[model samples]
Target: MTTGTHSTTAAGVARPGGPGPLADRTVSRVGYGAMQLERVREGRAAAVALVRRAVELGVDHIDTAQFYGDSLSNEVLREALRPEDGVVVVSKVGATPDPGGPRPMRSAQRPEELRASVEDNLKSLGVDCVPVVNLRRMDTGPGLRPEGDQVVALDDQLAVMTAMRDEGKIGAIGLSSVSAEVLRRALPAGIACVQNSYSLVAREDEEILALCAEQGVAWVPYFPLGSAFPGFPKVTDEPAVLAAAQSLGLSPSQVGLAWLLHHSPNVLLIPGTADAGHLEANVAAGAVAFDDATLAALDAVPSRSQDVPLG
Candidate 1:
């Protein structure tokens, strides 16, 4: 489920005491996900332009996937990027490519198969080894996996990734679309980041986010405005958020993003946008500052819980 609630940062987010991996990483706390850059021919140029613009604007992190167009997105990534400073490329593997596009297909963890995925992304993105490698598990399917099959054994995925890392094929290890228990079990093996659905309305990742904060791991919450979910609550349209946006003369989107930036230093938002104007607006949300009263007011909303939370 998704909750489209929106609000702004409450005062200044806890800044990095000094320099840290999560803080010093290339992408901004509010970074871009390159999935939106795919679709048609015209989209390619716009995506390239957006990547170039994002770098120029000090946005460092770029997330993509091998399943995205079977390497089309990777090609655009390399085309838009330069041998510059503070740029960390993060990509995921697991889903197979389809003729129409990348779909929720299946997961296979053979070492040779992973190698093929890597070769494709590396050649397309033109990178030796991407900074972050996200292992996308296949837990979403018809009839869903039984308890025994639902859980992906750590040793299995770790074996493949550990080999790849040792062979200098990946930098940091991360996971997407996983439960808190699964994440906890996988942490000891070197989980640098975790991507889960989290928001004011969707508290599925709430505990996971706090754990990441405690463990000093970066927590990347996708769909900040709640787009991935079907029945997610509308945070942006909430009475409190609407009132606050009206008070600030800001759009509902800006207020929503601002709330995440203010949520916690451990929270890293990767909102996807292809519209040029919307991209700039989304990035600008990273700079918003929410006051104490405003934070309270937004938090006061009686947000509904997610229908099927992994928390």
Candidate 2:
């Protein structure tokens, strides 16, 4: 497999900009997912600039959620792209949180409310239709309910999403924050993508990743760079990865992402960063190619150095 190929988009990234399953959608296989754009102590100014620069540097896909800051992220996204065109904007619903203060979360799928819920997302995004509507599946929780009743006992949130696909409110469907069992619940629906916690430190998803590859479904692995995992194996500290990086003259993070690009063509990397330098470094990783010897060494590295669970 080859690596280190990013297309230039003077206007913005267009789907199918490269090759493989992502080619049909204009969303680059190595596209940037925008969940990390949320403001911490700083406001949206820096994040907004980073996103705009991502477009300038040719990242075709930008994934987001209505629940991120109660649609405030979408608003910031809208403001940032006041100039570019032809970018694929993917967003999700299922959890809506308070944007102001005293943060609280709520689900908007009550069967009766499913239709309205999608409409709110369209309005919030300022787009007629979302390129993708990932059903934020939370099949486990207290006081948390699904849209339908006793009809489908398992993963009721999925039932509502399947109905909406038939109703035509969603274009292409996806799933997020799902378990292997919960993900299996969505398999019959022909979902376009699945975002789960998986990285060098979280190898529990290796099975799921292989399954997605066999099914020809896009696997958008989130937190691939050890997102706060207990005893997270520092990608920089990994002996083999460090040696490979030294050989290739790249950063450890870049080498980690390059390994992910090597994981499978179905794997779409969405490593997030608030800093511009970090963003460029992440993008450069897509260009780093590993030789057969380096790949074999990397393959020998255990998927999870620690038995830590995915976050």
Candidate 3:
């Protein structure tokens, strides 16, 4: 399945996207997002089984955060996987459980705080060092600009990750929910990947995705199904996307994910599902292919980024 830096199908066909540049290893472009593990009604054992199935289906990237389910995601991953499973585990820092909300995320941006967050992830995941760690910008949500005083320079946060890398606590660094301008400034500091909320109907990060491709940074897009935004139209509801799916005899989710893989060679998918059946369906999306007509139809779907802002 693997040859040098590329992962191929059993028939020797090339995958939709090539090997990720960050880990520099053979990896499937379609990856598993671990945030929904805690929401599964069957509880921890079922969550662990879903993770195992993802790997069995050839998933080579798993994205999680310490704050996801108050560290439940990483804990479940610890029970299900070992480093030898040959997958990259990516976690993020800069947000912690908010004391005010029923259960919301808050900023935790100091260097010491970031360092502690990294150690917390290490402890939870039971890994000597995570394959990749992303520094999420928490001062502002994904769609809005930050207040003048709230801005935290990328270099300041990079210093924390750089120190951790020097000490052998992390193998690579990444950025999440940041603007293209910020990514341009941060590239000199060394970024292996960039995580952002992008989907068939949400394209605000479009420029950032192109920049990542140009710079050889992996672009990991979360919420590819458009379900993360509770108020907006789901990808399945888009007329063009729905039509394409009907024509191909595929689910709307599969059509949406296949479009992302066709959108860019650097784009990496992290679609998440709590149910085992949904997990397998998400992985099967990797096989859906699009012709030029389908690609154009998907591209015309309106951008829904304004409907739901990510923070």
Winner on TM-score (1 vs 3): 3
Deviating ranges (above 4 Å) for candidate 2: 1-24, 40-45, 82-84, 98-117, 138-155, 229-231, 305-311
**In candidate 2, which residue pairs get closer than 3 Å at backbone N, Cα or C atoms, i.e. clash?**
4-287, 15-26, 15-27, 16-23, 16-26
Q: What is the per-residue lDDT of model 1 for residues 73-159, given as tens digits with 9 covering 90 to 100?
A: 788888887775356778887555755534443454455566677777787888788778887653421111324443546568778
| Candidate 2 per-residue lDDT over residues 36-89, each given as its tens digit | 677433677877788888776667677887776667768777877753455677
Task: Report the candidate with higher TM-score, 2 versus 3.
Answer: 3
* Best candidate, TM-score: 3
Candidate 1 has an lDDT of 0.67
RMSD of 3: 3.1
Q: What's the residue-level lDDT of 86 in candidate 3?
A: 75
lDDT of 2: 0.67
